[model samples]
Target chain A: MSTAKISLRGVHKAFGANSVLNGIDMDIAEGTVVSLIGPSGSGKSTLLRCINLLEPIDDGEILLDGIDISLPGFDANPVRRRIGMVFQNFNLFPHMSVEDNITLSPVRTLGVNKSLARAKAVELLERFGLADKVNAFPDQLSGGQQQRVAIIRALAIEPEVLLLDEITSSLDPELVGEVLDVVRELKTSGMTLVLATHEMGFARDISDLVCVLYSGHIIEQGLPSQVFSAPQSERAQQFLERIIRAGRL
Target chain B: MGTITGRRAAYERARKRRSTVVATVSSLAVVTAIVVLVPKMPRWDRVHESFFNGERFAHSLPRLLDAFVLDIKIFAWSMPAIVVLALLVAITRNSRSAALFPLRILTIAYTDIMRGVPIILWIYLIGFGVPGLGIERPWNSPLIWGSVALVLTYASYIAEVFRAGIESVHESQRAAARSLGLSSWQTMRHVVLPQAIRRVIPPLMNDMVSLQKDVALVSLIGPIEILRQAGIDKSKFANFTPYIAAAAIFLLITIPLTRTTDWLIERERRRTTGTRIS
Candidate 1:
């Protein structure tokens, strides 16, 4: 059995009695793509954010590498460094160039020298097919290009796990494939990825394990082929039917 | 069809004729008014005499130069104090702690009070009140007192300028930095403050220009700056030439600075737009 890179048990989050995430329990295994598919506001993004401690869970244990992250006096920054996150809106620093954006956290947090950081940034940018646009600012890049840069930025610190929150949802139809290509490449490279996406086809193609979230609960989870081809739960079937009928799956 | 075309032509002609009549009447009226009013206006002889007279110019030059140097010294002392105080005020104003709320409120009240009161009054209060209290006036110099008054008064305004600049930084910029695993201070120092300071530069330069002009107001406390020297020369020479010469000198110093500031504002505006585009 593969080791779990991230484990969540009895995770609960409430925003002023709304109860956005209620009792989420899941395990993301190392070196595999696990896609979380759900409707909007189904706590998919919240779960991903919790793993990075961006939104602190109200009640739950987030175990990263079999160690509880919420334990007293635990350093959240190092944990955050280990768990990279790509935001839905890209969240690229507008004032910084693509190279600076990628190199920033590494230099500031890890005390990496500028020359080393720059070389690393160039390598990542080149791998991401953005070598020529290194000096360009965030606003200069297209949505797909910016999102790719954001992924490279997160990956620059050599994170053990990466969380992608609806990364392709903001991209144009034609631009979506370019971003998905990067994710596809990451999956092939044996990176542990927890992706929250509405793109059913991309999820089915790239994910090894697929989990369907409904009303803050993982209603069904299994192999991507099993979940996509034959869902046992009525909720999963209904969601898949709705998504297919809407021509989105 | 011919009649309709003729009617259109007539309408166009009438419109052109009406505009011509209006323009002609306005110019004729202005010329007539100028002709009637020219001699009734104040004589240029006073202005001419002030410029040509050597005795008055020479008498005022010494006092004007002295006053100018005094003004420069006062500004030199006050500027650093204002920059540091304003930065402190900005940080306090932006702090999230509950304890910082009262400090923020007090800062706002202080700025408001300083802006409302006259600087001359502040100078007198500092100069005379300290002597009355047996403090022996630390510097015992009007230059020092004037500078103190200027710094206190302008620091309040500068603080507001800085606070506005800091607040103008997009909230998303801060969030982006935080998400990168940077602490609050790290995000502020690295990302937010750099952008904020850039945005505030042109306005800060404007404030500096205002400060230069405001230095003259210190003459009320008897610092013997350019304005003070001009006043003394005017009285001694029994002519307004010295005052005119001082005014000329002020213009000579300020006009270039004003042009430079305008150019800077335009350049910054272009850079901001360029950044937005990219």
Candidate 2:
């Protein structure tokens, strides 16, 4: 059986005159965490979005378990069903409570029974230490709590791969560590994760592989130690130096 | 410190005196104008005779109640239809596909034309002209024509309201829903519409109050509504009191709705402030 959970070859995307993802190649193995880190406008979030076809690629082939997902007539829905995403803004449905927000996709898209979805939601909430917040609205929760709920909401579908797009960026400085702790737990549990983040320390600590993206291309990629400690490319070395100088790493 | 407190007290007293003077002047002017106009007004003697001394009041009262009933019936039936059509129009307007352009244009044209021409003109054209085209009424009731007119005109306005509401929902919400594997329709129904509809409730309630008042315009099309009954009574007795009574009834119906509109506005304001603080 094939081991690659996701594979993207020469994936390209452009918005009018601005090319966002240019000739990108990536492979994510099963049950591994790969962190994509870069400065703003580096297209890390776009790449994460493109995997679920949330942002359509201008060119390339994306494969899941060696099955061509980018091919015409391929059902995007089932592909999306297999992949879950968490947003930077914690896009919890404001009209719903935390429990309802978590159960919405399972009940509506997957045809899961409400009672079953609710049960699963409660389980996930308990696991995330958010059992007490089940009936609270999204607006009633802190940023850290909301992001935790978003993660659990994505996991309710039991997806093979989880894509996180800067999930802690909108958080308060003091609240950032709480959300990263949940991510760290997911990493230990062997969830296949593709995370785009600016959290250098968290990426170094939790990621199996870290890929440095710059100007719509992967400038360097390797084990976190290789990329952070002994980057082969001058660009990657300079990027790390900038992060260290900024007192982030 | 004592001087500062005295100055603050003086400022407060001055502000109160200014406001009180303005209020008294306005009240005196309004009262003086009413006193001057009261004697020149038409006599209530003939009106009292018709309303209290005869069958005119009895006949007109039932007719007015029937008209009220018809108005309520028409409004109830047409509101749902308007909501559905407005939603459809709103969706088509927001569609990006090339195939939807024609539909978008047609909807825009429909809204523009209907909004530009008065509702009464549309009533006359549809009520009088459509029958000439061999489209027989299902039941020969003026209620149907008046309702058709209200729905057609109000649907256009409501469509714009729906579109504005939908547009007001943050674009980030749409992107977030899509990334979560929701289809376009699913995103709209589950995420966008709920928030959008909440934002629009106050305006929609305002429109409904206006709609209740506009129902009186249907009297122009030979319906024996409250206003029409008042006209008949006035012609018989040469008294304007029945018309005043009709005006009072209209106010009675609309005042509660106006209060509801105010309450909704206040609730929405509180929600917005609450969301911001959170």
Candidate 3:
């Protein structure tokens, strides 16, 4: 836990009467990818949101670099600055051009100079094979291109941890590869990543640790090879069996 | 295929021509009926003498146009004040901090009270009531107070428009902004307001058009704007022709503004859809 880049302990969240994340505890070691896999409405997205501080926790501590960030009166802004998030909907600012979208946070939040931020944006866009799209608006780009730009926008701030919430879930089946390719590149570059995703094969390929959530709890957490192959808890086994039955694993 | 397409083109052209002819004929009929039937009424002579006397209209036209300049002056100056104050009020109302809760409540009450009162009553209270404090010359001038009334009342309405625009933005966008580490104020300034202001321009222009006409209400407090000048001309000439002239003057300005608003709205619609109306 001391070496963990992110650690969650007894985290709980609920909306009205519906409890979402119940007593979650996990440690994400530095420079490793952690994949959260679960059925829909199983609190995967809620857990990612709580970690990013987009959603406030009802109880417990989320520690970043040994600091208890979820304690009351802790400023979430500075913590969020250290954690970048990409959404399923690719919530890129529609009114801004791709260049502007990528540069906005760096320029405004980090006080980076405009020209310098823009240079970083151009470099990221070029690396993603989207150099021609710098002047284009989000609506003008394909879903794949927009999601890649979203990743670049997050990377522009150079956050220590990146949280991806089903980043490729909204892309066309054919367009999914382009986005996943970026995630593959990120893995090689050694950024600590926590992603809530439904792509079972991609999760198996890239994640050092896989956590299978059911209802609102971590039902299983282990190496992907162990969880994907061996018989384990009844619920985890049932989940894998269903995935195999559906030809998704 | 060529012949078929040619025949379809001819059919389309014929359809357009037929519609145009029908529209023109119907419009002509309405105009002709108004012109011919209006004079046939029993009191047409008296009504014509009072309301449509061309000589009286000509006599009052120059004074009404001159007084209309005051309306324009008041409008031009009041508009900036209204827009600035309304944006401030709207942003104030959007504050979410527990510390700003009282300030937020104050803004809500401000908008409620300002919007609940009629513009005329606002003009009377701020215009007459303020001047009644006997502040002496230029400071107590009704023009200044009347413009202030216009600013306050219109700011409330525009602030509500701005609030609606702000709320129309999806919560996801806020989440996206916050996730990027933008402070709430930064989120609004950079991500939210740019979109909100664009979406609300048509409504804001509509409000401006209404304000252009409502400037006349200021005449009730004491400034001899076009409406008041028309009243003065009415008593002197014992005819209502000046009122028509005043209406004509207002239409002259508002018609172009209304058309420009429509053009802007259509352009925005086309922009969002990325399609031509045709």
Candidate 4:
């Protein structure tokens, strides 16, 4: 049997009286694409954040490669290093250049040599069509370019699973395509990817397994063809219907 | 048509130059008139003897300059001490970790009490009172006590400055850093502090100007800086000419510092906004 790469069991999260993730359970196998799709306040982003331990789950275990990492006092850095994350705001360090941003974690944390790290960073930038923007600061780049650089910085660490939380939500419509193209390219290369996205059409197109989260619950999940074309749950059906009515799907 | 336009532009440039020259001449004339008129006023001669006596000013210059060296020494020594202390206090004050809770309260109180009390009072308490308290070796030297007082007092203000810089960095930056698997301290050092320090440089330099001026306050503890030298000259000659010289020296340092702060603030604004006038 092929074991799961990242798994969660009964994960629960809350903020004061407001419950964000009531119960989340999923086992993402290696070399597969998982898309979490839901409207605002449904905990899609929260689920993605929990994978990298950005948000502590109130209860339950987050297992990465069959080992529980949710225990208190666990050194999160090792696990975090193994899982790459990209944010909606493309939070690249504004004070650092794209090259430095890509090199920082690898050089400082991974004990990579300065020249090796720089060489690797240059390679990634060139591969991603950002060769000219290496010396450019985050503020100097367009939103799409900044997000692409952020993705490259995440990949620089050579993470096992890439978690993208609404990575293209903040981009303009035209700019969204550029970032989506990068994700599509990553998927074709057999990367284990989990993404929370509002781009329904793109999600429908890219996801191997589409999960519809509703009010912190996974209301429906299956092959993208099954879920998108024939959702079983009423909540999932209505949600997709609403998106269709809004001309989003 | 081209000649007409070119001629008009030349005429406009000439007019601008003429107005600038006229403004300069008028400013000089006004200043000269004020100086000449003020000197002729009743009791101006006595006032001149008290504050502008050339002989006393020239004599006090060398003494004041020599004493000013001590002020620079105290200033140089106190800076690193205050910077290190303030940064620790600010980090402690800003920490959300439960273990830092007690330290947070202590730093808050320290900043509050130190800032609330006057620097002169610290000079009095540490510089004089510490010695009387029989605190042994380090307390005995006025230089040490005086520098300690300046450091303690200035750290509170500088800590607040550092804390502001630390907090002004957007929360998303921290989240991004942490999400990278960077520990909190590493994130702060690599990501947050760089931005924060850049933003606060102008304010920090302004604080340094305050520190530079307050370096004269060590004079109360018997280190004869420029101000103290003026007091010595005043008593010896029964005139205030030396005080005028000291004031001029103070202005000499302060004016450039103020201009530097303005220039730095402007440059920071332009850099952050990604806009510049060529």
Q: Which is the leading candidate under DockQ?
A: 3
Looking at candidate 3 chain A, the ten consecutive residues that score lowest on lDDT are: A227-236
Clashes of 3: 0
TM-score of 2: 0.87
Q: Superposing all C-alpha atoms, what RMSD in Å does each candidate have to the true structure?
A: 6.8, 4.6, 2.3, 3.3
Candidate 2, A109-220: lDDT as tens digits:
8899999999999999999899998888887788999999999988988888999999999999999988998988888888999999999998998888899998899999
Q: What is the interface RMSD of candidate 1, in Å?
A: 2.6
Give the TM-score of candidate 1 (chain A).
0.97
The segments of candidate 4 whose C-alpha lies over 4 angstroms from its true place after superposition are B1-42, B133-139, B261-273, B276-278
Q: Which stretches of candidate 1 lie over 4 Å from their true place?
A: A1-3, A71-74, B1-66, B97-118, B127-142, B238-247, B253-255, B261-278
Candidate 1 fnat reads 0.26
**Comparing 1 and 4 by DockQ, which wins?**
4
The positional error of residue B145 in candidate 4, measured at the CA in angstroms, is 0.3
Clashes of each: 3, 0, 0, 0
Question: By DockQ, is 2 or 4 better?
Answer: 4
Error of 1 at B182 (Å): 1.4
User: lDDT of each model, Cα atoms only?
Assistant: 0.84, 0.84, 0.92, 0.89
TM-score on alpha carbons, each prediction = 0.82, 0.87, 0.93, 0.92
For each candidate in turn, the interface RMSD (Å) is 2.6, 2.5, 1.9, 1.6
Evaluated against the true structure, the overall lDDT of model 2 is: 0.84
Model 3 lDDT per residue over A1-249, tens place: 487999999999999999999999999998999999988999999999999888889999999999999888889888888999999999998888889999999999999999999999999888889999898878778899989999999999899999999999999999999999999999999999999998899999999999999988999999999988884889889888888899987
The CA root-mean-square deviation of candidate 3, after full C-alpha superposition on the true structure, stands at 2.3
Which structure is stronger by DockQ: 1 or 2? Answer: 2
Native contacts, share recovered per candidate: 0.26, 0.37, 0.65, 0.60
Residues A165-234 of candidate 1 have per-residue lDDT tens digits of 9999899999999999999999889999999999999999889899999989999999989999999999
